[model samples]
Target: MARNIYITSIEGHAGKSTVALGLLYTLSREAKRVGVFRPVARTSNERDYVLEMLLAHDAVDLSYDKAVGVGYDDVHADPEAALSRIIERFKAVEAQCDVVVIVGSDYTDVGSPTELSFNARVAANLGAPVLLVLGGQSGAGVNRTPEDLVQVYTIAHQELDAAHAHLVGVIVNRSDPDHLPQIIEAVSATAGADTPVWAIPEDPFLIAPSLASLLDAVDGELLKGDSELLLREALGVVVAGMTMENVLTRLIEGSVVVVAGDRSDVLLATLMAHASETFPSLAGIILNGGFELVPQIERLIDGLDLSLPVIRTSFGTYDTARIITQTRGRLAADSPRKFDTALALFEQHVDSEVLLQRLDLNPPLVVTPLMFEYGLLDRARQQPQHIVLPEGGDDRILRASSTLLRRGVARLTILGDEGEVRGRAAELGLDISGATILSPFNEELRERFATEYVRLRAHKGMTMEHARDTVTDVSYFGTMMVHLGLADGMVSGAAHTTAHTIRPSFEIIKTKPEVSIVSSVFLMCLEDRVLVYGDCAVNPDPDAAQLADIAISSAATAAQFGIEQRIAMLSYSTGSSGSGADVDKVRAATALVVERRPDLAVDGPIQYDAAVDAAVGKSKMPDSEVAGRATVFIFPDLNTGNNTYKAVQRSAGAIAIGPVLQGLRKPINDLSRGALVQDIVNTVAITAIQAQGVAADSAAAASLAASTTTAAAAGEQS
Candidate 1:
């Protein structure tokens, strides 16, 4: 029989969907093939989102018709018959996979007195291990203390025992950040040594409903605004009951404003405020009472391009607000934010090895995009470092900071005025509590940074007065922090040029002892494998030796990220098939690599097709080991490297991450000017990993120097 992970929750809105998604993700990482099954579904006409998300994963191959069993009505009608049918259906799914993840029925209807028992019974009959989930949201009258969590776990454990079901794990979702440690300790003390427990702090963004869900809840019609804005989440709802001035004061980021359709003044003011940089961005606008925008007001705003959603609903403002508040966030496939947040939270808190050890799974074979992303975040979190984002004025930075803090990926210091940064995040309804907001104008830091800067640049005629003023820039201030050992790494370029971001680093940190120049590589994540493309972001036109150094550095970088190293010296031709100065330079670079690093697998003057395609590689260079499976590609120049990476990224549907800089004394990365929030997150994770590598190298160098001194002292004594 295949191993099964049964995820069950006793109450509604316990955030089990996220847990189920998380478990499926963890299992898919190592399991050869996985299956998802829902023994019972909601009584409503809509499909099960949790099951759909699981089946949508690249790891699963089952269909909806085959994955779902009976419904709640059938269970209520005949429990025995329903259980029998569920088992029969579940076995069919199990027959085709190495393991299966069974999502227990949701507690939608509160009337079922024996719902928890039913879940336990189902798991026992199916011979599956249960991973019980408890809701830990604490607020107002719903105070679930550490002792309260224990009591709930005790009851759930009793249910599992009575049904003879094995309890292997417990998760406390939506936990209070302040009491997370207490909750985990209390639960673990009672959950027994055999069962591991994890707790994820409640994230406001994860719990907030996207505008799409709110639109559906109110039966809204898109009146105007961008369709993509529907994906923006609504943190809360505001009823425009009063005048425009009063509503403006009540405005907050991700708020859905509900007003009567005839409130032209309110509508116009809200639209104007959203466009202004000083005001908070709304999730959407709902015009209730079955009214549409009037002709005069419509004409006034028709020429203006709005960025938020404006929906029209027939219900009154009061009714719309009520419906919007009850709408919950779904772990849908299209909802990338929720998906990433859930996976990050799970990987950070849960010990997947314990669960995998119980399953006896095999090692992973293929490197999918999702798998690569998960690995990056996991490795970065293992030794979390302090990374500073210099462009704190950007909204994307604030959003990314929230995600980083919530995921516990790294300690962050955002460089900006504390009041401005805090106020901006508040207007946007983001919780960036964990990040330390530092101002570039701090007197002590400014003086210290200025002194160091003048000292480092004294040969270049740098003045103390000039240095003091220069250190007030965010990029300079942040880089100085890294140089002073306050932060492990720095990531910039969201609001500045590449030169502006890295100029301070170049002046202060400089290159490593062995490296002559700093170059970069983009981790090209293909469908099933990841490739490295170097010199794509830095070095305009490198010489033969520089190209060889890039290949060597690229190889080391690939190792850092767990990618194989089969270097391909990309050129116009394969081997000696074509001759030119360009091809000759590649050949020379290839020879240099072979002479320096004889252990590394490398091939020269190879075309792109020959480097990647098995048949082409075999035909071009039959004797070469690196031709068919080259994971690292060294481009001759920036022109070719930049265009080629972009082409492959678009054509192959690959996720191009980073221009991750190599050969630096410390880890400093740059981002594109138009980077997204996810792009920022990926770059930060890469920066953290680079910091870890830098630390290891420094430690090794220090140990070697100390040993050499000791040896000399011993020789003198002899």
Candidate 2:
């Protein structure tokens, strides 16, 4: 059966088209065959704009006529017949693709009192999960209050449930950032844990009216520049009536300036602003009031290479501005930049992996290693982070860096001699120009870093000279970059031992205050699921306290990557079936986790079979929550964890994407000496995600401190 998702909204212009486009782009990267079906389009132009955009990007193979369903008028005339036709059309597309995205009707002039009911029925008939896109602004043109958002979610949920369709998730689109936290809290509380909620902050660029859109809205005549150039987006509008200096201040990048055509001075100033480096590039200029420029001025404009579009409108500046403001830019086929902006917005705001999981369309029943790696790359690219690779001299590292850069997963800094690195890249036929190359020994900051290093290790009697020598090592240099916030994170160990790779981080970066011991986890990308195996690369034999700490750290690492924290403390026994020192250690660790972090779902002293296979798990430990659904596994010792991860990697042909060290103040991951190019790419992605979490935590701490200080001052004043 083809898994389908219906992208629908409560009203018109709620950004459902952008959401559908973004989802199609995301799905195309993972699935081989994907198609789109708009169940009820607004027009009968025989050209679907959404379908054309997808085809322009080569995201889909279907034609526009085949992708579109009945028109709005047809659906309005006969609802039942139209729905049946919609279902049939959906099935036709489903037959040709592995997954099909069904776009719901836009609530417009063909509006019926039963529009919502009609949409719900279509979704139910198609047996597709619905992703609801709710506009953040209410009818009052202000940010929706928490109560208002909750009510919207409640109404949609009730309607979807009534139709017996799954409400996969809710996306609060075009939201004001200031009101997001409260709205998110309210919606989350009302929607419950199973339903995910995401809020996308308003991006002016995404919704900005293009020059072409403005011209069409006001019925203006183009006086200069190509019609194609006029398609460029105008992020803001400036009415030029003030002095040149004042007007220049109001002109932002991609802004259209409206002025009288006879005001040649203002026109000349606008042209100069576009040409100068001191001012932002203008999107276009609108000459209002039916005034034409003089022949000399027109000749002057022709003499200059005027790239900005100039439009002549019969209306006044105020009326033209009003028309432009009312124009909402559509994602046309030729608007590649706008498409990119929409994709970035959706990726940044919508958690695609979680959304796919909710739609039941990803991590296929038979998950190959390729699918696992694709998921990692997709997740990493959603929010690119800077990751430094210390083993830049290695061929594997260079090749992986090229792949990472090409895929837009992470920005990288390779630590090596620039000449040698470029030469190596040339030899490998790899383009690594996107990565920053640096030599630790030749950098101007070597001495400054050495001084900081001495201060960090002064308790251990580190002299300045000793620190200077140590800072020259690439591992130490990369770790220092992370500590000083020059780089977000570091990945090493391809050319060094695990101890050599992580020692600098331990000495300088240290561990988080909440953690007593640092540990490691290998993300075992199994056939059907990704599992976290911890204390695998560090801590040879930890005591019960350290084991408990490892479990906590491993759970955190798993959660960071979107994996649910169902922890299984692995051993030879299944729930007291055997007795030994190792088994006792696992039991103690499980007890500690329950006491210290009761929020985590953990069970222990379970065999591997019981931890993975549901039938065996039920037969062995029937009452355990973590037994069959364990996504994170904590072994008793390095001998078990390391050997188990490798065994699984080799025997099952799985992709092991880690040895990601956890509980560090900063992220510094290690790769195997025999790692492949893809392995390095995966590790770098993991490090970037770890860095993002650390940064977020720091920001939250700073915000809390500022709030507390304000409260204290207020109390004193009172």
Candidate 3:
């Protein structure tokens, strides 16, 4: 059955675009022919609607029926009579597509309940499902209530159901990371299990294009703003069916038409040209389901000289356009789940309880071998590395293994009995038996191991029998390889705790003398943006000096990732805004670091927003360089650090990369117990980079000392 998607909102500024685009993107990936149609759009100029059509069109490569630009003639008529004709337009757009995405409009002035009715009317006419976008924020001054959302949902659902349209879910957008937990709790209290909540993250990319921006982009002027027509609300289009006639006729006067790329032909182009000429107030066209623009339409565009621009998008442009109009451009960063990674990001900012209820994902910061393997696989695709898998693999393991090897990411090592491993590989149709498979009970290791084992045993004052038994495990071989310079680093821990993996290494390969502690840093990468959170894994409750150490260590680590570290000592307060023991902890930690290393610049006792947002930093603690623009956050305690890092990840919708271990004596790193193949690859690269840095530093210091000695000797001779 075709998925009937509808876009709505509880109030304004609750990112409808983010949720709408996510659906469009995901569905397009599934190869569906989708359409978008808006029932009612109040904008007169064609440009206001062009961006939505263009983005959906270009981003997904979906061909759209030429969009009709809306003008004064269509909207000046009686709103009721006009709406009927608009509904007819929507029906026509819905007729040619499999899935129709309907966009909604808002009545910001008088709070007309009819605005809600209009959305229901469109959904009811087409029998589509509805999704509403809402907004919430932490701190006072923001008002988001369960009752408000419930009322909106209830009213829209009741009307749509009566009209035969389904209500699929609600998306909360643009929420404050700090208040995400509260908002989720409220949503759960109101929306029950049946209505899924997709909290869209704060994506400035989805911020509603300003009237001025639209005007500038299309070289058009806004006919109305606060005085004439309130531009604060969003516009939604609706597609009620898959028939072209139905979709086109149902299109409201100001609606944009979304057609699939594969479906764009002469007939649809003609229809769009006719619609644009007939309705002087039509929005542009959006191509849905990712179809490339054909030359025929490009020729038509040149011949007709139509004012309306065309946009190709994923899913169906018509449905996506409908959603753009339906949601009223109120989507925010912290809204409901619109993207896959979006859910992961929101889970971090939200309360653990509320997060668990909203999305069924709870990442235990525990590093497992499975996690390491997965990580290694990802890294393998991006770069070359040697990835090790545990003996006896399943389909999941085999698929990951095959992909990594085929991609030439890393050399593969399977630890198990050769015959059993081959059997398992054949069962899964994977020929990884060709990989270097070593048996734990191999006699080669047994005989050679006895020789080295005896030597090491005598050196360490132990018996040969005891040494042989102790080093008999496969992990022993793996660690020994690293010790013997066979492998650069060893990443294992799918079934082992961090300590379990680290213990063997600590005993066999001791730390460097200068190293004081072992800690970890999670490299949070958001596209081109990167931030580092340190000691999140090893240090539970570090002292002031220890935090200072973490700050220095994380900064150095950031340099390895090509990021300039402007450290922020994260706390609940901003520059002593609130006083508490926790605040004091951060303050003292900041002081100790300054005292210990006067050269290392660091600032702390600031909130999360200030650390990342330069504007916020400038506004709050104007003098501190690290306040609003900090890249590194040193948390007062592990509880706050771990939770805050994850919260920023989920709530702010940021990507959290590590728990990259730091301050190791050598370049040995531990992987999560549940690590993927990619994780292993990244850990290895990171270790290599760290090692390379150590090598460079040693060389530079030696060069400096040599130059100094030569200069001194020349001065004595003179």
Candidate 4:
């Protein structure tokens, strides 16, 4: 039977999702088949942000419906059936996984006086060990003493203990860091020294509402500035009723200044403050009273390029202030920063190894495709890189750019006519305002880029005139932007040929120093796993040495994307079973790979079936580790690789996320000519990740673990 652990909190906004996400991540590192289940939901149509985050992070494989239980309405209508449905769904998840992380209900809906009781009943029925989370601050604010935390935990423990559910631990979440030690000491002393008690310090970024959240709370309308700015965390809320000097003194970074719409002086002062470095940056300015700004002030605000979000609400200043204060922070799907921060906090505070030992969960290694993609997005957002999309005229490109900006994936520079792009965006109802739109044909940029291009290709006898004409092309211009350090990487080919897209890059950016040839790999996201198919879209027919290089490069790409590297060099024959030109080439390549990269687990002259099918692989090469469990497959030629990827994509119903080109000095990815919006988005994200120069070094992983351990140790000391 799969080990089951239920995560429940005493009340809403108790940071239950943080605990669940942290547990899922921790368990996923060891568990091959980890599943998540939410026993009850607030609404039927309400999207489960926890489940979405898990899926996005590649922590769990269960679908939303199976992972989440019946809606509150259905449960209210028929309690018994709802419990049965939840149990049935949970069992389905449990049967498929080594461990199941079940989440209890949030007190989202009204008239739920027995939410805790309901959770306890479900925990008892599931016979799962429960990890109760309690809000450390309590109802008053962050003034809760150590005794207050212990009291809350004691009450929760008594309730779960009475329900006959095993209480494995208690997590005191959103606690003041300054008092974390006292709280933990108290909880341990009172609840029992042997019992596990973890205190997670409150993170302002996690608890603070974004400008958009505040806007929604007040039902405000966006009056000026970029909507993308609304995603900024509102760290402070200030009502601008006082004098300008008083407001300035009180302002902090990420402060939301609430003022009446007619308060032009306050509005102008706030904008100027944001403009000046003397004062902290303003997150946004909220205009209350529904009073329209005077024409001159409105024009002045519009003419200036303000990065701060400005919103207008119908409510008066005090009411708006009250609403902003009362609005609870939520973990939106787009907020990767908060998710990462939460995960980091959990990892720092909780000892996952101890938790797993208590839960009696021992899972094996299983890498799912979703997990791979999630890692890609996570790494990309860790340090956002600048990416340029040259084919901004295309609606798909525009849409992808908007999505990237909204998700905080990358800073984008879309190469096109600003007016035309904006017009197209308006027609499509796309928000590309966050993106920097640059005209490739702009005289000044064209001249500057031409001069740089001439200098770069001057050895080839290229003149300024020829350079000027070349730089006019969006591809050349975009590539030049990367070359000039204006952008980190570029993604094009939506309306251009492969040669046209890669030509400028090859000319200007060039390949890495160690790489003799450039190759491409399609991250074949199959039903169960993510496999790397190498040289799929680049080299037509690589020599033995080139093939070996491709294998090494492909392995690095796999590791960069969080795919463990076990390379299989594909041919028509397995081992020394056959003697042919193709087999000989693969055998030579395999030898070179072994010679060059001895640390890499690579085997070659292997047939496709033997590479993938365990039974066939064992029959052919019984002692080979890379044969059956190959996560990276190296094809002999482009024809074979391209055909195989397309066939598997169509026949197996796979979602192939790449043909992600590798071995450039800087990242420059090409998209399929017929690529959809999501494809572009994924490609752009991949490009941004690649630009970060993450390598395939186990030392890097070791270093990260060391840092996490160090942080945990520091926290313990504190």
| Worst lDDT 10-window in candidate 4 | 422-431
Candidate 2's error at 111, in angstroms?
Answer: 5.5
Relative to the true structure, candidate 3 reaches a TM of 0.43
Candidate 2: segments with Cα more than 4 A from true spot? 44-46, 55-57, 110-113, 225-229, 242-246, 362-408, 412-718
Model 1 superposed RMSD (Cα): 5.5
- What's the lDDT for all of these models? 0.87, 0.82, 0.55, 0.82
**Model 3 residue 709 distance off true place after TM-score fit, in angstroms:** 12
Candidate 4 structure lDDT: 0.82
| lDDT at position 243, candidate 2 | 82
* Model 1 misplacement above 4 A: 1-3, 11-13, 31-36, 46-67, 77-100, 110-127, 134-166, 172-193, 197-349, 441-473, 711-718
Better of 1 and 4 by lDDT: 1
Write candidate 3's Cα lDDT for 1-718 as tens digits: 3444667754444545445554553333222345555544545444334225423532232333322222224544565566567566655655655455566654333334455665666566656667666664322326555455446556555665565656666666765544555555667666777766654445432443322232233333322112211221112233433656556555544344445556655335434543343432334444556555578765655565443434444554444654554332333322211122332333333232432233222343333222333343333334444444442343344444544454344566766776656544432334363367777567776666656656654767867677667666656666665555555455555555678666656656555454455667887754335678876777888877777778877887877766677888888888878888878888888887788667766888888888888899899899997877677777777887788778877886665666677665445566676666445545555655555555566679899999999999999999
**lDDT tens string, model 4, 1-718?**
8988999977777888888888887776666678888888768565877667666655466677778778888788988898898888888888998888888888777523267767887988988988988887766575568887777777777778777878888899988889888888889898786689899998877878878788888998998887876776777888889887887788876678998888788889888887765676677899999998899998898877675678999999789999999986777666544655676688669987799889886545455554555556557777888999998789789877766776577899998888778655643335577899988888998999999998989899999999999998999999999888889889999898888898888899988888888889999887567889998888999999999999999999988877889999999888988898888999999999999899999998998999899988899999999878888999999999999999999999778877788888888888889998778878888998888873323348789999999999999999
Q: Which 10-residue span in candidate 3 carries the lowest summed lDDT? A: 224-233
Point to the candidate with the largest lDDT: 1
Model 1: ten consecutive residues of lowest lDDT: 135-144
